[model samples]
Target: MEPTQWTLTETFQFPAEYGKAVSAQEVKVTAGYTEHQTEDAVRLSGIYHVAANVGFDGEGKEATLDSDAILIDDVDVQDQSGYFEYAVPLLVDLPTSADGQLTATVIDASATATDDGSLAVMWTVEAKLANVEAVAQNVEGELTKTALATDETAKESKQEVAQVTEETTTAAVTPDLESSQVETVTGYVDDNEMLAFINDLEDDVTVTSFRLNDVFVE
Candidate 1:
């Protein structure tokens, strides 16, 4: 059945990769995100907040099938924007991880207008799944080609001649170092660094890592 709300223009995974193994918690943390941008001024004339989901669909089906959710993240400077970004959190206990479509949809939209007609919204929902980025995919690095030059050996040397020869050696390398010459950081930065980065944002932002059974809702 085709969706009348929003048609699937294109189908692609969020990170375009999936996990074949599960994690320690028996759940696979298949991480991914999506952007849903609303178009058509008429459709977005007076719309405000947008309700989003980052879960998965039914098994062996696209995200549009039956999926749980990670969480919904709000987009910036999106007054009329139906655009949203989110990540899926896999908390189920199982072996190996998974990769699925990073699906996005306009589940619910509210009209802020005084009067409404069809109460329509034009949105572009893009989702992705099964994303496998190499360990160094987001990694920044450089590479160069090195060539060695050797003088042609004396072809007619019959006797063992320890001839003094200068050989050309090539070495290509660069600094992955931070260049400060201080102690190198081995792992990801602490929350301080994360907070500092958030401070750079133009709008208010909050970042938190929640643990299950640790959070209680009324």
Candidate 2:
């Protein structure tokens, strides 16, 4: 009687492995609106990509998984469809694999001199990733500025008005809160003058920059 034969194989990709694990079983992209139009509209051509930035983590860490994967950029996409309904995986050749950040930058590949042709896309960038999921480290976060230093006098005036109203109203009787986790946000109130500053502060906020950048995914 003859013996049997067996073989074991595994495919290790650059910087990482593409397994049945949490990898992109399939990516489904939805088309969103454009941002701005270029003068030629040729520059108006919309394009985007998904990329990963691999770097070595501090010692004690095995390696960085950033470059092992790359972003799916417009240039790499197949022109199989007329519209932008494409997605590519971040496959990079990483030397290590412990920590890294992957960014899916929707590029505006316009040959314009100025940043005049920025597109305001109403696009929804989603992914069908495996256990190897991706998350952005940097988002255009918003800034909340409720009171303007220049409005110091104005706020004082308004707070005075609010205090008067509050004092006159019997409805000012707030329920007595009694809890172990009572968090009374005490602030320096110069004779109760800051109350009027609470106007439409929602509309007074703005996002000036990307607060956090070092995002990682596996």
Candidate 3:
């Protein structure tokens, strides 16, 4: 989007403690400010440093005085219909949103001594405002699906195991079952498959060791 350009002018008087100046010369001005977006406007707040050489009390002696003045301004982009409108596109591409960049540069300044023992200062600033398209990313959809599938599979397996346990416990006892035997079995796991499965889990999960057919697998 093209940048929007504008000019800002401000005038203010110094405090009375500086004394009435017979002559004020060699005026210098500098500014430091910050900008932010607020709803349909860009708000600016900062301070301006004004310095000048002053001759006071009808004497030839001159002294340099420096003063800081606060500056605040806002640029409202609301149209007559009460809707935010702009010539350039916004960073988020939305009206009524403050997402942009604003910069100001000092253009001109002047100082004058007033009859009330104070110095008057005036300055002009040139500002440029612009915004770019916002960047966005979508990363959670696939992970969320995978997590849901894993949870559903685990739940189904648990239900099947519970059903089998209940059926076995309810079966009638037989005399031929006087001698029962226990069996121990071991199984092998593919290292690459195990590593890949572990890697797919959430970062917060910690897998120490698991048992497969009475054998511990790490």
The candidate maximizing lDDT is 3
Worst 10 residues of 2 by lDDT: 111-120
lDDT value for model 2: 0.28
What is the lDDT of every predicted structure here?
A: 0.28, 0.28, 0.49
Return the candidate ranking by lDDT, descending.
3, 2, 1
TM-score of each: 0.16, 0.17, 0.34
Error of 2 at 89 (Å): 1.4
Provide the clashing-pair count of each candidate structure: 36, 32, 1
- Check candidate 3 and list the clashing pairs: 20-117
- Candidate 2 on 1-218: residue-level lDDT in tens? 11112221111112112111112112222222233323432111233332222111112222233333222222221121111223333222212222232222322221111121111122233222212332231221211133354477788999999998988684557655653224343433532454445443466564344445654545
Ranking of all predicted structures according to TM-score, beginning with the best and ending with the worst: 3, 2, 1
Model 2 steric clash total: 32
lDDT of 3 by residue, 93-116 (tens): 113233356565567867665554
- Native-to-model Cα distance after best TM-score fit, residue 77 in candidate 3, in Å: 46
Query: Which stretches in model 3 have alpha-carbon errors above 4 Å?
Result: 1-19, 58-100, 130-218
